[model samples]
Target: MSTPQDINVRQKPAVAATGGGTSTILATKQLTKNFGGLTAVDGVDFSVAEGEIRCLIGPNGAGKSTLLELITGQLAPSDGAIYFDGEDLTGLDTHKRIDTGISVKFQSPHVYENLTVEENLRVPLQRTDRDVDRVLAETLDRTALSEKAETGASELSHGEKQRLEIGMAVTLDPKLMLLDEPVAGMSVDETDDVADLIRSLHDDGMTFVVVEHDMEFVRRISERVTVLNQGEIFRQGPIEEIEADEDVRRIYLGENA
Candidate 1:
């Protein structure tokens, strides 16, 4: 595990592109989603680079989940286009999008409690062409569950369960990972452990698009922050700029601002 300083979690100048170089792994253009008379995700443009760790933060009802669902193909957008790895993904279904290197881990841990950590990993690995043993070992080491490989999912702590789900998501070797509230319900030490795991994975060339409300956790691992409000992008920049913005302070931070 590396310190925040050692991990390169500093603010950067504004840019139209993120990740590494000009490669955009995921992009949503004029993305919108509505439920009858109510709009959840209004027209919004969002993009993430190839190897960036981007955090999406906002208040409840800020359309964070809707936006994530739209991108993941769990819900269809009323209008808009989604592109991934330089191809259109707007009309693709959830499993199809996943087949193309887009994987999502929702807020809850969806592991098989009766299965061991390694067995849970095998569920997803069997779907891919990779060698099961090699990928399993790597995933265990990456998620810091190497010693707990044979432990049943039901026996693991809340944080360990979260890590197991993450490991399963990576079994297919996704190019872009959408993590919703990765640190939700985690203790201080657990959160720190997860953050360190995330950083370690990023260092290994993984791209992540995370939706998290925990500001301290966000500050721990984010290279950039995207602030969403009222179903749209209120602001997007480095964490420093976001923390300094008067409008963001007023709407999101409130008295703390």
Candidate 2:
């Protein structure tokens, strides 16, 4: 079996700002996804700047998840293009995209319930040639799970499991991380903890594209917000700016906005 020490990941260099002084790490042009007759994601143009946090929000069926799938290569786009690290990644496979420094953590905790926290970290780094013990220690520290390293994943609290999942993603040393509803079901304290973690990572030069519905959490961690409506981008700006728009307030935010 492969071991963590045996895995050595080769990361791509960070891309500088391009195309009209925009330093977008990931960009999509008229990106669309369809399932036969139903268009899940309409032609949408989106972009994420390097080392920035961007949140995607909308009412149900706004294509937030679908847009995420397209960017991560879980579902191929029916039209448009995907650019990552300044290269075209429109038709790349999931694994290939991952190789290009993209990692994703879905809404649910996707951990190996039977494995210990340390073992979970070991599994992903097994193919790389990095030091297994060292990486494991670092990952535990980074995710705030060092004390629980020996505990089984099934025994971890929901928030701890979420952090563990994030730890696993970071082992890949990705430049951009996609998080879908990361703080869902987390307590206020837990949400704060995750937000702190995300900010810390961003401070360390990581870029993130997050999809969340909790406006409180969005307000806590979001630098910019993108509102999706019926498979298209309705508006994108600072959280305060998005909150002030009457149409967005009436449509998605309701009385809350």
Candidate 3:
């Protein structure tokens, strides 16, 4: 199993950067996904610079989850291509993508309810040098769940479960992480805590593509934001820039401004 001590910090590749390093760590060229008569995701071109926190947001049924599934290989795209670390990832399976240093955390926490918090993180500890104990401790600490380490997954609150989900993802030491509505249903305090954890990971040079409906949280965590509407790319740019665009506000943000 991977342990924290086994993490080869020097061997990890640098993430693509907005101005320097690699142009983009993850990019989608006209990616599309459809379900028979329903086009869940239209041709969408998306990219995230290394070390950047890119947020994907839109109204309900805007295809945010479908786009994430496509990028993470949980679902194949009907058309276009996906590139990661300069390699085509179109046909790769989800496990293969995970092996390539990509991890994803769903909006609803997926914990083994019968297990302890420590055991929860052990599921992803199978292939890395990450110390199970260390990762467990750090993750619990990061999520303010240190006291809950021995608690059963079934005993955790909704927010604690969410934190544990994040802990599991980090144990993989992924180059990039995709989080879907991480703070959904979280209390204000829990939301702040989760945001702090995200910032901490970003500071460690981790790349992220986050989908969220919380505009306040999005503005706080994202360096860039991508807006989608009816499965199409509505707009993408710096958070402030996207927020200020009139068309984006109307079509995606639902703002009169």
Query: Sorted by lDDT, highest first, which candidate order results?
Result: 2, 1, 3
On residues 1-257, what C-alpha lDDT tens digit does candidate 1 reach at each position?
A: 76866434321211223333457777888999999999999999998878999999988999998899999999999998777765567777888988978888999999999999999999988778899999999999989899999999999999999999999998888888889998899999999988998898888789999999899999999999999999999999999999899889888888454
* Candidate 2, 165-223: lDDT as tens digits: 99998888889999999999999999999999999899999999999999999998899
Worst 10 residues of 1 by lDDT: 10-19
| TM-score, structure 1 vs. true | 0.90
Q: For each candidate, how many residue pairs have backbone atoms clashing (under 3 Å)? A: 0, 9, 9
* Per-residue alpha-carbon lDDT of candidate 3 for residues 108-158, written as tens digits (9 for 90 to 100): 889999999988888889878777788777877877788888899999988
Estimate every model's Cα lDDT from 0 to 1.
0.87, 0.88, 0.86
Error of 3 at 187 (Å): 1.0
For every model shown, what is its TM-score relative to the native structure? 0.90, 0.90, 0.89
Q: Which stretches of candidate 3 lie over 4 Å from their true place?
A: 1-21
